[model samples]
Target chain A: MESVRKKRRKARVDETLCVACGCCVKVCPLGAIAVVNGLYARVDTARCVGCGKCAKECPASVIEVQEVEV
Target chain B: MKKTNQKHWYDYLWIASLLYLILGFFNILFAWLGILCFFIPLIISIVRGNKAYCNRYCGRGQLFSLIGGRFGLSRKRDVPRWMKSKAFRYGFLIFFFAMFFQMLWVTGLVFAGAADLRQVVTLLWTFKLPWHWAYHGTLIAPWMAQFAFGFYSVMLTSTVLGLITMILFKPRSWCVYCPMGTMTQLICKARHAGEKNSDKSDFVTEK
Candidate 1:
């Protein structure tokens, strides 16, 4: 028996779950996460460092991070 | 702690675009290399569509788009407002007209064999033109004024042209209008059409 799941986009930050905090923005080493729309900042997944600052500083703890599979 | 920094192979393309532009086009210094940049990617794009150099590569395009995306100038699948942006519309008008006149003048000179280094320098210079007197004569006109204006025109042209072509038609205008894309598709077509003809005989024999 096997299960199939749709592959989600890697390292995407959900805008809805975002609490408009700058922690992830600050913590990113790559300068990837930018506060767009003035409130809910956006993270460019392609540029994410995956250091987990976003996951940690996210007061809502909603910054979901992913790694590229080798 | 052992340091681990991971990066992608494609990053090289960005650097390549920069070096190519710097050593090639900026001076018109390397005629051969500039020819490679102008013609090769154009050939590639025509054959492959957006992937050749426009979408995935082409350092200039990548950088321009990155800057625009940074500033929220990127367009998505959604229909973007047309001419509704007076700034954009007028900006593009000014840009295209300027480019057109400049190119026309250059072409005329080239035909007349009067083109010189002075002309090239003037064309590339920020303060050398008439508009500079009006707009860039302010307190902030000296240093990055050129860069800002260049970016402004480049981004606006690329975006507006893309918007007009893409939103107005399907599969976008890269198929036809883009010089680089058009040239590439021409090459690809010539090659693929030959392959298709070859494949037809094989198919009939198999059947």
Candidate 2:
């Protein structure tokens, strides 16, 4: 049987909150973002790795975190 | 007025020198001291926040950030809420404990006598791991133990831990659970929660 693990904490970016500095884009290990209008970044959601690198890197602290058990 | 991320690109002066000399003294220096230096900046980063270490002090991480920026691969931080599971907790537990183990093992050796000493020495010259033989090379001899298998183990574990956090939380989660980050964090605990002039993490917020 294959092992399946569910994601517990959702990583989020408030577009209004995000400065679009591109730190998140540069820091994310997995390719989960597409820059919109050459300004803000949006996560593909499916590919995100929840490293929290984005959270830490976020200047706005707009990335609110909610931890759940999967 | 300099651009927000622009200053980050120009600061690489000691990037080479620091890692270069410090890596050489890995095993030669007292183990805890070596650990201390590796983490001082990291700790500074932690208490200081990820921006400090990720942007200012860390040589390797900076290079990655720079390249990622060029690729335009930089993305906003976002994910679903359900992803936060106990698995992240467990992974963090293991990652944190492992770091604790290293500090304890070293401290224990000093307090408990040769038993702890033997492990470090064994770690140094076990001549057991498949990669051990690499230490034999002229280029490899200087960094044989710590830089080779031991370093690999630490980096691999960190990388694995990092991967886990990235997959579930965000990239660079290791900075959060990172032992090195913890140390720096511990050191910088005294600052007000607001702006730290000494902090590079301030860049993300410094308007």
Candidate 3:
């Protein structure tokens, strides 16, 4: 038997660059992102499918999607 | 590649917010224009089934971003956890509506000849400040003027609150708990849910 490897995509936010504008929160289709304490946008890896909607809508361009091994 | 700093036509809406404040300063009656800010977001949310107005067209948010981000007025700190909580946001919305209804009640009293119009703008829902200088006895009814005064007070108070929070936290932090933003978000979610249900029904019919 062989073990299987799975890769998934998730959105990441750069807290240093985020302006906490809530644009990503409004555009997130899965409601996977929220502005945490009005500080930065935090993405829930479980809910985010790396759809890139938040990254596209972010005014600060601080969000990026990357593939991760699961 | 999308340029993060690129300016769009909607980016200039900050000017409109400034112009509105200035106009209301000289003549409080001009505050009626605030209704556009109140209704346009709801209308766009209902019609487009999105938060496009809040995302792209909110003048107040733009103004906050300009002053706090561009001008470096904000401390760029994190807002308190309580301010960002759902309980606080919904409570603030309910309180805001209660104050709005009280404003309408006062206006109704004036309209029904049960009370006299007071040329005062209450700040922070207390501390009545005389606003007689702004009025020149226009042809508009007294009740209308009363409503304008009350409405302008609400708008000004909210702006002041936004400015204070902007100075204390990150730019556009006010959007996190803005009553209008909350309302529009709810409307957008409701619309999306309805669309999903309709799509499921269509799929079943096809099957």
What's the count of clashing pairs in each model shown?
A: 7, 36, 0
Error in Å for residue B69 of model 1: 3.6
Error of 3 at A59 (Å): 12
The global Cα lDDT (0 to 1) of model 1 is 0.40
Instruction: Give residue A29's lDDT in candidate 3 (0 to 100).
Output: 65
Per-residue lDDT of A1-70 in model 1, one digit per residue for the tens? 6766543334456654333323344345566665432224466655555677556444334467775542
True contacts kept of 2: 0.00
Candidate 1 docking DockQ: 0.03
User: Candidate 2, residues B1-207: lDDT per residue as tens digits?
Assistant: 323333444357335434533443343222223354365455554554333543345543443334333333334243333222234434654666675567455545445444322222222222333433223334423332342334434443454444444444434333334454334433334343434333222333321
Q: Clashing residue pairs in candidate 1, if any?
A: B42-B180, B42-B184, B43-B184, B46-B184, B46-B185, B47-B184, B47-B185
Q: Give candidate 1 regions above 4 Å deviation.
A: A1-70, B1-7, B16-33, B42-56, B75-177, B194-207
Q: What is the TM-score of chain B alone in each candidate?
A: 0.39, 0.46, 0.90
Q: What DockQ does each listed candidate score? A: 0.03, 0.04, 0.13
RMSD of each candidate relative to the true structure: 15.5, 13.2, 7.8
Worst ten in a row by lDDT for model 1 chain B: B198-207
- Could you tell which candidate, 2 or 3, scores higher by lDDT? 3
Clashing pairs in 3: none
- Of 1 and 3, the candidate ahead on TM-score is 3
